[model samples]
Target: MSDFIPVNEPLLDGNEKKYLQECIDTGWISSEGPFVRQFEERFAGRVGRQQGVAVANGSGALDIAVHALRLGPGDEVILPAFTIISCAASVVRAGATPVLVDADPVTWNMSAEQVAARITERTKAIMVVHLYGLPVDVDPILELARKHDLRIIEDAAQMHGQACRGRSCGSFGDISTFSFYPNKHITTGEGGMVVCDDPDLAERCRGLRNLCFQAHKRFVHEELGWNYRMTNLQAALGLAQLERLDWFVARKRAMGRRYTELLGETAGIQTPLPRTGYAENIYWVYGVVLEDSVPFDAEEAMKRLAALGIGTRPFFWPMHQQPVFEKLGLFPAERYPVAERLARRGFYLPSGMALTEPDIEKVAKGVKEVLG
Candidate 1:
């Protein structure tokens, strides 16, 4: 039997070890260490942002960004229902209401048309979450923001190097966020960042991530905040990884192309859209959605794949379907059919940065066998 192929493993064959060694030798493992600053500057510049505020993790980045924008109490943040719960949770935690929108059938992203329809007098912001490997159609959303005098928060946590219409994903919003989870194109083990062009918004994020520390007086706080600082060790790793982002993206695209070629003719599954007019699919995880004719859903598909030593992961369950949100008395009558179908039928194969050609072949074979 072949070894079990996990869903994701990061590629760290760059200067990761060298930079980490420097940090250990220099005793700069804390969040205040020099590498944190360097990483922030480089990453911000890479994403076309003027400022970057490093945070503990992706969720923390979202929290800081939401608070920095002052979204609270009666403000409505329009977002896609087919996204990670953190998007909705961030708005909810700010005492704001999250107005859900359905996803595009082909792209499986937030529908910009739906966003225009959902806007109201109280709509304060639009949270654009770039899903999987494809950026949400952001130009229309940007137009909507401008027309309504609303703020934009781009969640590029899953879209480090992705672009829409030649513009970098992180540069499309008033404020943007990125995640450095191990499964991402670049990994800091556990880290995230908030990036923006506005100096004031950037400063607000920095203070919010550091417990709202006062510049004039120590241990004095005018407002509440959280300790969501990213450590130097993580920053060191991130800097090294960032150096190889272009290559990593290319490698991922190759892996995705190979998977598509192998599985293109397979029945019962729908592959990711290879490209749209705006951008090509980065194939973040080489996701597959079961067709309605398939006998089982993603859960059963994952079970079968696991038995064959092939790892798989289900797509995000729609926020509208979340019991917690239902309990919160949110979206009582709202229904997003596309999101609901994708959640039930979609799952991703192993498409990690560390995945080799042989691994891709094996995983593709396993998928075919299981689905057959």
Candidate 2:
């Protein structure tokens, strides 16, 4: 197990220890501490947003964002069918219907055109995710939302430092969310943040993150909320991670390039290619999709890689095909062709910021050995 390269490993050789020590010394370990606000401000500033409200985790951030929007059962929120359940689950939890759209085969993000087609009078918001470090073609989404008078909530959990055209991924939306899970661009171990330009929505998210209690009276609650607050210790860790985010992003990009260089031409597999010009694919992980000629699906390929002491993860299963959705009768009649294919064919190699050149080489070599 020690010799096996895990799918991800957090790189924390920064001020993480120093700040954590400071928090311990000061006894500022709870959610209401200086480090929390500092982390919020710096992160919001980095993402080009006016405000950021820290939460417990990515799912909690999504929930708070949807809740802040005040969406309900009669309303709808459009998002990609290819993403994690958190995207749709947030909408479902807010008593809103989740409208699923197919993914773009090229970028693997949701198809903006498909999203445009799915919009109805009841549509209240469009949640756009910059999937796997590749920014969604969000200009058209912005235009579509503007024309329809709908809000855009950007999921930037996997897209730190990635841009769309000239703008930041999280800046195009009415509100945006980020995750600090260890595998993400930056990690706070388990944390998330909601960023936005509107002060009122910011306050709403803040209130929603904590129990929506009145500031005047701590025990007096005006609305329902969750205990989604991020502790000062988490914030201390986050601020440390944020300090070297640029370096982390650069290292990841390099690792991705290395994978593509090694595996781009591998038989029966389509490796992720880096794009230039504008906002390039940061290759959150160097994903590969097996062609039909391949003898194995993602599951089989992953097994083979595991035997080689390599780590890999399959692409997210399409939301439309999920058993939970099927049981709930959510997307029984819906289909997303690209997402469906990618689910079976695609998988990503070890791509954490901690990966070394040799680590990437080993992964690429193992992949070629498996699929060649």
Instruction: Please give the range of 10 consecutive residues that has the lowest summed lDDT in model 1.
Output: 1-10
lDDT of each candidate versus the true structure: 0.92, 0.88
Q: Give the TM-score of candidate 2.
A: 0.98
Name the regions of candidate 2 deviating beyond 4 angstroms. Answer: 276-278
The total of clashing pairs for model 2 equals 0
Task: Give the C-alpha lDDT of model 2.
Answer: 0.88
TM-score of each: 0.99, 0.98
TM-score of 1: 0.99
Best by lDDT: 1
Clashing pairs in 2: none
What overall lDDT, based on C-alpha atoms, would model 1 receive against the true structure? 0.92
* Lowest-sum lDDT 10-residue window in model 2: 270-279
The deviation in Å at residue 143 for candidate 2 is 0.4
